[model samples]
Target: MTVPLFPLNSIVLPGGRIPLQLFEPRYLDMLTRCMKDGIGFVVVLLRDGAETGAVARFHPVGTYVRITDFQQLGNGLLGITVEGESKVAITRSWRQPDGLNMGEVEVLSEEAYAPVPETYAELTSVLVALCRHPVIQDLDMTVDYADARQVGWRLTELLPLDKQEKQRLVELRDPVERLSRLQELLEALESG
Candidate 1:
């Protein structure tokens, strides 16, 4: 399926929510079309270039996201909150005349449900503590502690991890593997 691409410096995994301030004509147009068509777009991390102006080079893997809520911010730019619905791989991409990037994508299958292992049980508690913060609470996230995917995605979202590291987590198709990778990162963070 072909979809509009919104390249950012960050990675948004499945079940993550991100708010974007849209001021560019290309993206504003894209938003209108997406909402009208009731179709979501792909959010990918940029490998090069900035979010505005020149067309950015983005990673092939991205999260297919749907707009969940929207509001008119005081600054006048359109504010929209989107939730990642599924992972997608961009097989091809091109820049439109308006500077919007479009991609021919394949939606990846959802990871099989795997329970959070006993060894990683402590990660769930860390996530619970992080969620109490006002910023996370504002997102109104629904987390399932028993699910390995949720634990990995939520931690990756809230942690101050590098973008490349987060991208690696997002690209992993296995929930257990993602959790194990996350544990390694957490350990590194603590030891360093």
Candidate 2:
């Protein structure tokens, strides 16, 4: 399942809302095409040497996202809402004529009901509290616990962490390991 690519330093979890400003010509073209085709694109993390047009350095794990809403901001900037649909891996990437990057992506799917560790339930409660904290309360959000197995991904994105840490979360395949790592992150944030 090849799809277009939109590289950012942020993690977008399934059922999450990511607002983006599209001003770059290539991305504008990508957005237009997505609207025309009724399809979405993969949101990947930009790795080292990205500015040099290095296609080989992007993170493999990404989220397949759909454009749920769009509004034209002044100065030709587009305010777009991206709703994550699924995970994907980058097979390849190429530069499009309009300057936006496109990629050959393979969508990844998890089992319908992967067992989540008991500890995750506790961690999730903490995360819910953190989301409601006064500092982050104005972020315009909601709590989605539809997939317990994906709670780690959602936390990784919600936390104000560095891109490297989020990338590590995306690469982790084991649910238990991912949950443990997320717990550690939350603990660290709480202590700080």
Candidate 3:
């Protein structure tokens, strides 16, 4: 699958909401095309591996984001809310004449036979408590473990975690491993 790329420093997890300001001409064109075709674009994390005036490097793993709401802001800026749909891997990237980055991508299917591990229940309880704490409750987060994969992605995105840490969480295929990582993070936060 080929996808128009939106490269940013922010992490967009599956089932998460991302609001973007599209002011660059190239991205404005990209958004126009996406809206016309009723298709989504890929949101990839920008890394510091590209030179000046060059296309920024992006993590291979990204999520398909559907535009939920869009409005034209003043001065040719666009405000849009995107909901992440699924994870994808970039196979190749190329530049368009308008300075937009496009990529050939493959959507990563959800783990076929994996079941939500028992540990997730405990982890979700802990996370809910953390969210309800007076200090952090204003963060306005919602925790739902009905779908473990979605929960994992939400946690990975919402936490003030670094890119490498988020990548590690994304790469973990086993539910148990993912739950363990969440538990460890929560514990560390509690003890710190």
Off by over 4 Å in 2: 49-57, 74-76, 133-146
What is candidate 2's lDDT per residue for 9-114, written digit by digit as tens? 6768676767888876677778888899999998888775453234435688898999988999786778898888888888878876655677888877663555
Q: Flag regions of model 3 displaced more than 4 Å.
A: 49-54, 73-76, 112-122, 126-143
Query: What's the best-to-worst order under lDDT?
Result: 1, 3, 2
Cα lDDT tens digits, model 3, 1-192, are: 888988777777666777788767787788889999999999888766432246688788888899988888786778898888888899999988877889999988774434457766766665555567674453343545666765667677767677777777876776567767987887787788
**Candidate 1 residues 1-192, lDDT tens each?**
999999998777788888899999999999999999999999999888999998688899999999999999999989999999999999999999999999999989999999999999878888999999997888887899899999998998788899888888888888899888888888899899
Candidate 3 least-lDDT 10 residues:
135-144
Scored by Cα lDDT, where does model 1 land? 0.91
Q: What TM-score does each of the candidates earn? A: 0.97, 0.82, 0.81
Candidate lDDT values, in order: 0.91, 0.75, 0.75
Show pairs that collide, candidate 2. Answer: 26-100
